[model samples]
Target: MTPLVELSGAGFAYEDGPPVLRGVDLALREGRALALLGRNGSGKTTLMRLLSGGLRPASGVLSLDGVPVSYDRAGLTRLRTSVQLVVQDPDDQLFAASVEQDVSFGPMNLGLPREEVRARVEAALAALDITHLRDRPTHLLSFGQRKRAAIAGAVAMRPRVLILDEPTAGLDPDGQERLLDTLGVLSGTTVVMATHDVDLAVRWADDAAVLTPAGLRLGPAADLLCDPELLTAAGLRQAWSPAVTAFLRAHGLLAPGAPGPRTPQALTELLGGRPHP
Candidate 1:
């Protein structure tokens, strides 16, 4: 199948700074989640901006579906509707009074019918499991609640590809799990999220892509998360789970032997001989 989004040899730079991204190439296939991992100021956000058409690249090409993206009015609208970007900070995205209004803003801006917009707002809230906050003031919500609301707003757009920047930042343990579960349920959508939470990326993303001063590196989520040297070089740390380690040790696949399971199914296979809880 053709990729939902593609970036080829894309490069960008700010007014006075050196290039934020250099020769970056990415492809988001349907029904796959790609995690963009990097430290602060590593050009992750800049790449998102370029993909979303918020900022045009100084060179190279970015295409959604098959059409090249430009700064033209039609291209902007196409990019906006096809790829919805949830900003890192909820405060920047939530400007409406109520939670419902904030979530409805995107579809409303697209000139969708009032009923359609209402249905989308309701569905987005339900997907994020925040229907209870529909009437609450956005400013009064907790940090986690605000993050969910921000995501709901992006979901309201019904975009084919969703780009979330640092979705797990500033959340408590419960909140993080809840948000991960929310992301887990989004089927048939191409998701590219930039997160420093290595554990979250390991558990939630189908593949992990690291952003470094050198360039973008794509590989298995578990392998990338387990490598301390690679993580440190990219300004990241592993999110090692105890259960994963135990399973690997049981199968004699933890380092010294063969590589351990990088996915849940593999873990299950390795532990199939053990009695179930």
Candidate 2:
């Protein structure tokens, strides 16, 4: 499948500073979730911002669907409509007095008819399970609620691609799971996120990209997430599932062909109350 977005030899430097991202390449597929892993100051944010059209690269090519991305007013309007970005900090994005208005803002600004905007707002609220808070004041919402509201605002735009920066940050375990479930159902939209949560990234993303000062590496989650050298390069540790799988395999309790499950429920079912030998 053609990628929703592709980066080739992409490099960026801020106002004559040293390059933050250098020759980094990525191909984000439609309907697949791509997780970006990196340490602080590793240019993950720069890459996300570049992809979302917030910052243009000083060198190399960034394209959407094989065509180069345009940065002019007409170009941006189309890009913003096709790709919605939810920043890591919800407070920076949410400015409306009420949840409903906040969620409706994007569609309304799109020059959509009022009724159509209403429908989009309603669907976005329902999708994020924030319908009950529709009339609530934005200031009174909890951090999690605010995050959901922020997400709803973007989802209301019905973008073809959604990029979230550290979306799981500040979310509780259950909240993370709920968000994962919601992301899973974004059927035809490509989802890209930069997150510090290695465990979730291991299982959730269809593909993984590890960003280090050296460069960026992209591959299947299965191959890249479990590689210790790659993990160390990106300042990440081995994921928990692989360790458990190794232990069980060594103990002769698990079949050699047994599949390692990544999620909590999958692990619970796989163990089946089996006693440790």
Candidate 3:
């Protein structure tokens, strides 16, 4: 299948600065959850911007469904409506007085009819499981609630692809789990999340893209995330989930052909209550 969005030979650099990303090529598959992994300075954010039409590549092309992306207003509007980026900081995105207003902003700007905007807002709020907080002030929400609210604003646009940067940052374990559950509700949307947490990437993403100064590597999460050399090259450590799952398989506790467990609870269930050898 053709990629929903693709970057070919893309390169970026700040004004007169050294290149942050060079000759980068990436393709986002439809409806697949992707984890963008790299160290702090690996141009992950830059790549996300390029995908979202926030930045024009200094070289090469960014294509949407095989068509080259245009930076003109009409083209950008199409891109923004089809692909939404929710930055790491919710405070930067949410400015409306109330949750409902914030979520409604994007659709309203799209020149949508009042009823359509209302329906979109309702569905987005419900998807994020924050319908009850609709009337609340955006400034008064907790960190997790604010994150969900910000994401709801993007969801209201009904984008085909949703990109999140450091989505689980600053959240407690419970908050992270809740956010992941909420993300699960975005069933038809392709989700791409940039994160520093290798374990989260290993367990949550269907595909993994690791960036390094040397290059970018994209493949099945189970394959790339388990490779110690690739992890080290990307300045990431091997995730413990795969290690434990590998041990279980080696001990004959797990079927050799079975997919690795994504979490501690999943590992336990897969073991079928058998004691560790």
Best candidate according to lDDT: 3
Output the TM-score of candidate 1: 0.87
Candidate 2 wrongly placed segments (more than 4 Å): 263-277
* Local accuracy of candidate 3 as per-residue lDDT tens digits, 68-149: 9999999999899899999999999999999999999999999999999999999999988999999999999999999999
TM-score winner, 1 or 3: 3
- For each candidate in turn, give its C-alpha RMSD to the true structure in angstroms: 3.9, 2.3, 2.3
* Candidate 1: tens digits of C-alpha lDDT, residues 29-141: 88888899999999989999988888898988988887788778988998889898999899999999999999998899999889999999989999999999999999999
For candidate 2, the TM-score is 0.94
Error of 2 at 188 (Å): 1.2
User: What TM-score would each prediction reach against the true structure?
Assistant: 0.87, 0.94, 0.94
Q: Which residue runs of candidate 1 sit more than 4 Å off their true CA positions?
A: 239-277
| Per-residue lDDT of model 2, residues 1-277, tens digit only | 7777888899999996888998988888878888999999999889988888899988888788888888999877777888889999999999999999999988988899999999999889988999999999999999999989999999999999899999889989899889989888777888998988788887798899999767998998877888888888889878888777777889886799887766556667777854343
Candidate 1, residue 31: how far the Cα is off, in Å: 1.2
Pairs that collide in candidate 1 are: none
Question: What's the distance in Å from true for residue 74, model 3?
Answer: 0.9
